[model samples]
Target chain A: MKSLFFRTISVTFFLASFSGAALVDDHIHGGDSHLPRPVVVEYSDVESLASGNDDVRLWCESWRFAGEANNLGPWTTVPVECVSYVKTYMTGKRYAFDLEMVSREASRFARSIQMRTDGMDAWVFDIDETLLSNLPYYAEHKYGLEIFNHGLFDKWVEKAVAPPIESSLKLYEEILGYGFKVFLLTGRSEAHRSITVDNLNRAGFRDWERLILRSLDDRKKSATIYKSEKRDELVGEGYRLHGNSGDQWSDLVGSSTSNRSFKLPNSMYYIP
Target chain B: MKSLFFRTISVTFFLASFSGAALVDDHIHGGDSHLPRPVVVEYSDVESLASGNDDVRLWCESWRFAGEANNLGPWTTVPVECVSYVKTYMTGKRYAFDLEMVSREASRFARSIQMRTDGMDAWVFDIDETLLSNLPYYAEHKYGLEIFNHGLFDKWVEKAVAPPIESSLKLYEEILGYGFKVFLLTGRSEAHRSITVDNLNRAGFRDWERLILRSLDDRKKSATIYKSEKRDELVGEGYRLHGNSGDQWSDLVGSSTSNRSFKLPNSMYYIP
Candidate 1:
């Protein structure tokens, strides 16, 4: 028995050793706290940053590349590779393919569950990138190559004209069909609920049981804490959050993590 | 107040706009069910994968570049960039540097906490990459460039000559000096406790109050569930887990997550 046990540990070590890439992919939901603090350089560092620095590259690339969900930054100047990444991500079909893949996975998860029919079976969806495409807005703005502009994007949101992400659109309909209550938990402020509702309706989203936009009170709370607290409320009311999907880590990470979570692709930007 | 509220939501949309990269870094602590399931492909797809395939690149790049924690298997034939990543990561100073940053953060967490001095304040450390360097073993084994050899690595473990990671060694000592009880929670099978103790002692980890190695019965438990369950046990006993660090995501993620958590760089390997 002992010999056999040693053999198993040995085998685990072998398999464990080979997948080292997994370590580098530490996407932060809470405090990963292991990565070196991102170099928040001044404008002086931009020239040297563009020229070459692996540390800066790693920091910038991990933020750009690894996909921790967030919307916090006065970012360093964009890297040359990032343009390629953004292009490949936005212009190409890969983004669409990933969404299709996730929707398919969500469909599978929804199908496997036997719903209670109590209106207590719930699935949460984060607004913004998860359900809607801000691509057209991003495209006109140099694909996020330039620093983000607040007033302009807010003005853009006020228009309530963003289109549905085609892939998520399918998943959204399918989940509604699956007898689960749908909750739209968005970072959009509560004041914008009417526009947000109209936007979701116009974009082909319909029949969600609740559109829970962030209240003014939740402004200072981190997305994880805010979302999780909301989820706790739902759970406290006997809701079973079986499905959660979002573009940002905060949407699905931290407490009250869903029974099955799905992350879609969006490589052009990050949110804290 | 209403105008100010709109302003906040508007400001959020802008930060939310540019950072699409978070979609790629799906850091897994055991199973963040939402992480886009890694794109697994058939062996037949290698030719297409090696060619300019965006899906393949996204799949390969997220795993290689992002910092997810696990030792999941059937990973894609690692891309060329990953090889370079592994080489640069294992051979470079980044790993140690990240550890230093985490240690410093942990020091802050430790100092901020007012421990009861009931001697029940504790910290948890995962063995293997967290405390000991398996670099020597990996060096001989191409730093996991090749398939791991179980018998060979086990023989290496039996030799019990792993060195202490300098940064972690300091943190361990400092945490100990702070009057916190130390626990080494390792995934190594319980059968190896004696050797594990001798090895840790030889490598400068002395006076740990308890060395908890897994029993044969734990084979079916996922690391996150298993580790979190153990933490629950500790918490039930009224020990406040003040700090935790590990090279693997499994070491730190999930329920009873510590007050402060730190991850060490180990792009060379992952254990689920």
Candidate 2:
């Protein structure tokens, strides 16, 4: 039922009638006694019919630019109405483009720095979709399908069976070869640290430096704020964040953001 | 009654329950075979609860920074639940801060330029809430309280009686004093041109350049896209936009967004 609580796939049915403001009759019933009103919607435009709302389009656009969105869950695909859009997004060709971006960023990062002589230059990588591919899981679960099963996901993590994201892996290896210390930063709770590490290792991620995980308290904060604080802490330690990689904008734009950041693609879920 | 379609004051009653994704149990049946489900909302923070959903908050923040948000109407006050928050935001003291920002920007623009010996320097300002204050009208109407009456609003506009926003008035005069050509870029259609000009004059905005209004087709585009295209046209004409001022972010951002842009305070209504 927890999964069912989130299964409203067609936003047109919900948002169109209301605009979240259009109430029943002429007047909006006051806060004290307003009964929930049924939503009535009519769709005319093909493009709009393809997606939920402008918010959805903005999410896709923002993710393209900064890998940012509310982290709801992968394959919880009800909000995004356009079937072909998501299909094209999940294609291998798109993956190649994302990898190309990472490669280009890595090359740019390498060319920009003089290889700091004294301080430890660090590069942060968000685990889930940055270094490893979750397409298999998403393929099975599918967006807007059954609700995300944390236990199942945990088991998947424990298996450490996810394959390496080739482009990110290439970028990872390239950065390591450049004498930069690599750290892994993820939103996963610290409780899952051991399995996450094992997963990273099994998926061909060899790391030198720390693996940062969110503590229980950090889970309550928004992803952007939480990640920013983490970056702040990293900077406080006198480590220069020269480069960063993640599949979310929260990983890239924030307090301790490095000189440059690279974002991978993951439209299966949105994490705010 | 048609005007009433535009107003809804409690963002809480609307946005919270639905996220625009929550469907009401009854009226939704009119649209299709949509079901009514009990909504389960868990609010952990004061901030998250102040507005409608994360999307709304994101829109507000984005509008603050880069001037991006879905085209939610200004009085769509159905989801923003924090009364005191909106109260503080609408305060004259806060307006003073906004004006101070405008003043500071004006001074900065004045000091930075060397009397631009090159191309014809230009400045763009949006009409509503930029040169004129709509506080008096909104004071009576109040967001989300009554329907937005176009005839009544048109009567108000036809009066050519909107008072000059003090800070913007100062900036407007200052820009003209410095010999920069001024243009009013607004989403208001061409039919409103005469009254807009009269309103501008009554509001003490006298200028050198032009007042560019939206056409029938241009009205369909988003604010950013429309404003950007206008700026593109200006650029094509070889006008270098040196400064822009507006109450909305769309005016300040986009193509030919001058050397700097200033945004005024007007949370009373959101325009796109």
Candidate 3:
């Protein structure tokens, strides 16, 4: 069973690599580079930014690796030295490539399982940065170096214009096609529920079993606790929780995590 | 308090980077390159390896990022296409640089805490690929292209000459200096305790609060269950388990996880 699963991924890897090459080439040389405020900033020379020393680049890469691996727990902000590095990564091809890898792995896992007729098997997804991209907002916020202003971020959220993370939307579609129920669980306050739904619908997330947001009482709790409790409630309702995807470790850690959890790369900000 | 911690890490990062540059230079240009079987193989041009396409490189790197983040689970071997990439990573500067980043962050966290007078504050570390590296053995094995052979691996372990992962050795020393009790919790069988101790001592891991190993009864258990049960025992003994570090997620996951867990980069193989 495992060998067959691996063989399928390897074959898929070849196909993805070819498609990914074209996608990357288009982004690198496309007309979007001419825009004053490009949605995805394409850097002709990534190292042109100051502090372009090899050591600094390696240090910043290592810092991101640690952050993704959850080694550096609960960091408040990107390191002052890593600001430009984060910007280049977030606004460049690497971030998209990373997401492609994660979502591919996730969809592969979801396909490997046998779906029950009862339809209890479910995949959980976090909303912001998992399904939606706040890259445009963070782009103006110095890629999260401005110390995360809630009022400013909430105003951006109220616009209901965040784009879908393309790879995640693909994963969402694949999971739905595989007959797994999709659940959108997020740390966003319930006050923004209407806008969140609008954003989700506009960004192509039209169907889900539920869109869970933190209530006033739940807002006071840490993300780990609130998300865990929400997952616990889903489990209590007899959902299998086969797969969970999130940009934050807090979304996957704590009690009642899924059979498999996929973490999307996020370097801008850390939420405990 | 957090800013002070970040400041200390930033200072340490500069110091470590300078020292790391020298270390990397020595490995790249030194006598090891001339050995019949170099201990740490250095590549003049990493792209010299076959299948060095840009897309394939990005794909392999994404695979690694997923593995390190625990998004990829329980695979027996590295992807066949990723063999060269994994080899380059394990024997190259990037792996060491990643380790430096993790250890530095871990030590920073350790330093930020006010150590209690009670000697109950403990740090847990895994043995193989965490404290002691088996790279020399894996280097001979096509960097894990060959599936794991227990007989051959046990023979290598019996030789009692595995080298210390230098960065982790430094972390062990720093944690000891900070008044934290060091506990070596490994998945190695208890039958190899003597050689394990001899190997550890030879590699400069001279002291620890305890060296916990798997007994006969533990052979049937998965690493996650075995390590978690052992950690539960430590917790039962009134130890705080303040920090944990390991190469495999199985060593860091499960019950009694530390306040902070450091994951070292290991793309060669996955252990469940």
Q: Pick the candidate with the highest TM-score.
A: 3
lDDT of 3 by residue, A37-58 (tens): 1122122222222233665666
Candidate 1, lDDT over the whole model: 0.60
Per candidate, native contacts kept equal 0.02, 0.00, 0.43
Taking the tens digit of each residue's C-alpha lDDT, what string does model 1 give over A125-217?
A: 988878887877877776756544555777778899988876677778989888889998877777788888888889899999888876767
Q: What is the TM-score of chain B in candidate 2?
A: 0.71
Compare candidates 1 and 2 on lDDT and give the better one.
Answer: 1
Comparing 2 and 3 by DockQ, which wins? 3
Candidate closer to the true structure by lDDT (higher is better), 2 or 3: 3
Off by over 4 Å in 3: A1-52, B1-52
Which residues of candidate 2, in runs, are more than 4 Å off? Answer: A1-80, A144-146, B1-272
Order by DockQ, highest first:
3, 1, 2
DockQ of 1: 0.07
lDDT of 3 by residue, B121-204 (tens): 999999888888889888889886665666678889999998888778888998999999999988788788999999999988
- Candidate 3 chain A has its poorest 10 consecutive residues by lDDT at A8-17
CAPRI-style grade of the A/B interface in model 2 = incorrect
Question: Residue by residue across A154-252, what tens digits does model 2's lDDT show?
Answer: 666667777777656666788888888888877777877787777788767886588887776675555667778888888898888877777665566
Winner of 1 and 3 under TM-score? 3
